[model samples]
Target: MTLLSTLNDDMKQAMKAKEKDVLQVIRMIKASLQNEQIKLGRELTEEEDLTILAREMKQRRDSLAEFEKAHRDDLVEKVKIEIAIVERYLPAQLTEDEIRQIVLQAIEQTNATSSQSFGPVMGLVMPKVKGKADGALVNAVVKELLNNL
Candidate 1:
């Protein structure tokens, strides 16, 4: 099923079950999707949908990191739960090793021999790993592998 339809079903279930956290996150996700569609004035493709979902995941991860740094346990706990909910929708993430292999192939394709080639290597890697891996993690991997070259 499409993300929206799945969210709608989950929303109904959450309401019936009175699961406040799930309901709130589902509402937020639906709103984000609807807002994007309204902003673009077109139906979003599946890839665009995944892009939005990935952005949501990234935003939560950033918030989680900040919360942890500030030692805000209360907020940290809440954000972690939200992150878990977001994870339910995302595709299975690429392992570090899987990501490493992809980065190696990208570096090979671009003949990237130094950190200066980071941009070209990343350009080649992101599409192959899009929605299946975190951009920040991919960026770090590219940087590390290029630095070793």
Candidate 2:
């Protein structure tokens, strides 16, 4: 099933099971998906759905980091759970090693021998890794590789 339908089914199950946290997260996902559809005036593709899920996961991770810095363990734990729930709908993420390999290839393809080529290299790489890798991780890898050149 598509992520949207799976999410809808899970939402209903969460409600029936009285899983408040899970239901709340699912509702948030549904709302985001619906809003995107309305904004674009079309239904989302699977890739688009994955992109939205990734964005939600990224937001939760950012919140988790801030909560940790503030020593808010309760809020941190809640955000961690929310991140896990959002992750259920995303594709398997690329490992750092995998991302590095792709970045290396992009660098070669773009003939990017220095940090000056960061923009072109990233433009070439992001599309290949989008939705499957974190932008921060990709950026770091690109920077490290370019510095070594």
TM-score of each: 0.97, 0.96
| Model 2 CA RMSD to the hidden true structure, in angstroms | 1.0
Scored against the true structure, residue 73 in model 2 reaches a CA lDDT of 97
lDDT tens digits, residue span 1-149, model 1: 88999999999999999999999999999999999999999888888888999999999999999999999999999999998998898889999999999999999999988999988998999988888999999999999999999
- The C-alpha stretches of model 2 lying farther than 4 A from their native spots are none
Top TM-score model: 1
- Please, what is the whole-model Cα lDDT of each candidate in the order they appear? 0.93, 0.91
TM-score quality measure for candidate 2? 0.96
lDDT of 2 by residue, 18-136 (tens): 99999999999999999999999998988888788888988998999999999999999999899888877777889999999999999999998789999999999898887888899
lDDT of 1 at 128: 88
Candidate 2: residue pairs that collide: none
Candidate 1: pairs in clash: none
